[model samples]
Target: MNRRLFTAAGLALFATASLAAPALADSLDQIKASKTIRIAVDLGSPPFGMNDASMQPTGSDVESAKLLAADLGYKLDLVQVTSPNRVPFLLTGKTDLVMASFSISEERKKVIDFSEPYGVIQIIIAAPKSVTIKDLNDIVGKRVATTRGSTNDKEVTTQAPQADMVRYDDDATLITALISGQVNILASSPQTMAAINARRPQDPLEVKVVVKTNPYAIGIRKGDDALRAVVDEWVKTNLRNGKLNAIYTKYNGVGLPAEMLK
Candidate 1:
């Protein structure tokens, strides 16, 4: 090819590449300039993020976001997100950060940055007192219920492959199946089991075994280090001041876990 033609082609390619690249904006600066910060939360997840009787979002994650916005002197704009959509929402700039009980994991870290963990969750196997389930072996041959496509479902399927798995559309349905005697065991989170216990105080479910301990943190888009640093500092300060614990207690009826405080 002629030198002139080669040069023109190179310039065209460079322009196309630049146009395809996402415009990187300083998240903190944008929030400050706009006087607002958008946060994604799963309003369907209770104690962590859920709507109150008045249909207003009010939960541990929601309250934490509110505190963060207050500290930054910006208005909080909440966007409802589900487990599958949380990361996409943040990446697409629909939200500045995600505080919807997002559990930090190596796989997710590759796509997004996480602030220091501010909360912890225990995935457990819960069953009625009548059912004696000491471990995964005991779960064998038992009818286990879990939310379809959830972390609990994946764990149960892996750990107790011998067990009869009954998947429900959602957590509420899975819990119901267990409580109503349709299923003998349930794989669920501690907070979710606590809700079930509250509803059926007389029945009294017990935890058979803990499957995993997950640390929850705020999720930011990758390369947004400035915003991530600010969030991390804010979380550290709140953890030390007990403000984070207070927010957790307000929703879960208990203070933050001692391990999480560290």
Candidate 2:
């Protein structure tokens, strides 16, 4: 089966899967009892979560998860997940928390809880510099690639319904699509754009329009109030101590929004 088609089908079953799955121990107490916190991070997303030179997990989200586990005095168990599976993993007891650049949205809040915003990501429409895209109309009929089941996908699909939408299973694949000429335009983040440009510096892509500036947060299962509170407080403490900001800047090449720091 085609990966894109498979992703679309899987996304459609999210609600059904969440409702049918059996529950597990996902409380703060349970996490403490187990002495491990399973955090779902997308290893395919660069600057946020990706393998380093030695094939070890190393990225903003990866480091953030480590910091969280260390501070909370638990063993860090990183659960590898993609954009679409983050919420499902949490709901089905496969993971305790999701820190995979998961954006907070009203639609998502219906199924899961979110911690206070720890960082911000700008979703933008980027294309080759030569492409004239001053507005949404310019994207019409053009192939626009994005990671399936991401905030970028939602924003672009909602705003540019006429564009030719090409979805990939993960950001790594989406980046590959852009770099390999599978698509000239993409809906992604500034950090992702930087990654793309780094690989194809000679014909680098530039942001044509800012889709939205979204605040990404850790995702906790619904009704996990104790875990939510602990995660939220951990975010606050890390933001105040500059630990989170330092991690974001190290990979993204920019500091987080000033408001988020507060």
Candidate 3:
């Protein structure tokens, strides 16, 4: 090729590459400059995130966010989000991080990055002490209630297909269905089960079997390596210093599970 033509082609390629490349934003620097970190939390999920008596956000996730902000020398701006909207908010730049009891899953990993697990929760099949349910097989042919579209619902449907499954719109309704005798067994998070037991201590429900194990982690927008690294380091430090356990126990009434310590 002629020198002139070669030079022209090189220029064109460079311009195209520059135009096609996404404009990368330094999320960590942005947060540092703004002096605030916006984190999304699910106010509806107790123990993880929920409203306190004063109707303000409070829970394990909330406390974790606070600690992260404090450690990073930034103010925390919590954005209330529902379970379904957590990722959307982060992807859309509405939040810097997500700590909504978000469990690390293969499906979610495709869209967003996750930090090391900060906590773990079990989805258990709970029933009145009088009723016996040792495993999935024990629940066969029995009425079971779970929140629609939850991991618990999916686990029950997949593992105990023989069980008569009833889906409710929310955790409160599912717990109600179980307590009201509408269902023989309830599949829910241990946190929700604890709340139920606290509210109705006389009924005395016990976890029959754990159907699913969920490890909670902070969700970061995909490709935000700086922010992800910072979060991962912060989580590791907290886990090592026992702050994570204190936060978990503060909300869930128990220490961090051994399986989640790593």
Task: Report lDDT per candidate.
Answer: 0.80, 0.85, 0.79
Give the range of the ten consecutive residues with the poorest summed lDDT in model 3. 1-10
Worst 10 residues of 1 by lDDT: 1-10
Instruction: Tell me model 2's lDDT, rounded to 2 decimals.
Output: 0.85
Q: After superposition, how far is residue 25 of candidate 2 from its true place, in Å?
A: 4.9
Where is model 1 more than 4 Å wrong at Cα?
1-21, 253-255
Give the C-alpha lDDT of model 3.
Answer: 0.79
In candidate 1, what are the lDDT values of residues 1-262, reduced to their tens digit? 1011111232222222111124558788898899999999999888888888999989899999999999988999999998866766676678899999898876667557899999887778988898888888998887888889888888889988998988999877876776677776778877777777887787867888988878899999877889999999999999989999999887876567786677
Better of 2 and 3 by lDDT: 2
Error of 3 at 131 (Å): 2.8
> In candidate 2, what are the lDDT values of residues 1-262, reduced to their tens digit?
1011112233442534224346555478888889999999999888899998999999999999999999999999999999877776777788999999888877677677899999889988999989999988889998899999887898889998999989999888988888888888989888888888889888999889988888999998877888999888999999998999999999997688788877
**Candidates sorted by TM-score, best first:** 3, 1, 2
Better of 1 and 3 by TM-score: 3
Q: In model 2, where do residues sit more than 4 Å from their true spots?
A: 1-18, 21-26, 125-187, 200-209
- In order of appearance, the predictions have TM-scores of 0.82, 0.72, 0.83
